[model samples]
Target: MIEYCLTVLGFVLAIVGRMDNLRGFVVLPKRWIVERFFAHLMRSRRLVRDFERSTTSAEAMIYWSMTMLMTRRLARQPPRRG
Candidate 1:
C-alpha cells in the first residue's frame, strides 16, 4: 500500500533486504549512508524535536539541515588549482 502511494507520487522505492543466515553485526549496502545522513540531520537543533505543525515545514527543516551539512563539508575542502 505504501509502495503504491510512493509510486503514484513518482518516487521509486528500493527495499534493501538482509542476507539470509547472516552472521552478527552485518552491515547492508547503502544502509550506512542513510544512517550517517540521519545522524548528521540529528545534529541540527531544529530537527531534534517535532515542533513543525505541517509536513511542508518539517521538509523545509530537512532541506535546511542538509544544505548546512553540504556547505560545511565544502568549506573544509582545499581549493582546487585551475
Candidate 2:
C-alpha cells in the first residue's frame, strides 16, 4: 500500500530490512539517518503535536524546523581562512 502510494506520487521507495543475524544494538544502514532526522524534528515544539490543519502546512513547518536547525549549526562553525 505504501509503495503503491509513493509510486503514484513519483517516488521510489527502498525498503531497508533489518538484519536478523545481528546481535544487540545494531544500526542498519540508511536507517539511522532517518531516525536522526526525526529526532531533530521532534525538537521543534510546533511539530511535537499535530497542529497544522493541512498537509501543506505540516510540510512547511518541517522545512522551517530544518532551516532553523541548519542555520544554528552553521552559526557555530568557525570562519574558514581562505
Candidate 3:
C-alpha cells in the first residue's frame, strides 16, 4: 500500500514539473521579432526603394544601422566568468 501511494505521488510530481517547463518555454514576440523584421526588410526591395525616395529613409537607415550594431555588440560580449 505504501509503495502504491509513493508511485502515485511521483506521477503527480512529474506532471506538475512538465507543465512548468511548457509554460517557461512559451514567450511573446519582442526584441528578437523586431530585429528579424528589419533583417527581412533589408532583403525586401519595397522598403529599399521607398527609403531611397522618401525623407523617412534616413530615419529607417539610422534605426537599422543602430540595431545591427547592437546585435553585433551583444554577440561578441564575453559570457560572465563567475
TM-score of each: 0.76, 0.78, 0.32
**Model 2 lDDT per residue over 17-73, tens place:** 878888899887688899999999999999999999999999999999999999999
Model 3, 1-82: lDDT tens digits are: 5566578765332111233545445534454576786766665444555546566876777577667667877889698897
Lowest lDDT block of 10, candidate 2: 1-10
Cα lDDT tens digits for candidate 1, 1-82:
6688687886777777888898889877699998898899899999999999999999999999999989999889698899
Model 2 RMSD vs true structure: 2.8
CA displacement after TM-score superposition, residue 17 of candidate 3 (Å): 66
Segments in model 3 whose C-alpha atoms lie over 4 Å from true places: 1-51, 79-82
Task: Tell me how many clashing residue pairs each candidate has.
Answer: 0, 0, 0
lDDT of each: 0.90, 0.91, 0.60
Task: Judging by lDDT, tell me the better candidate of 1 and 3.
Answer: 1
Which has the greatest TM-score? 2
Residue 21's lDDT in candidate 1? 94
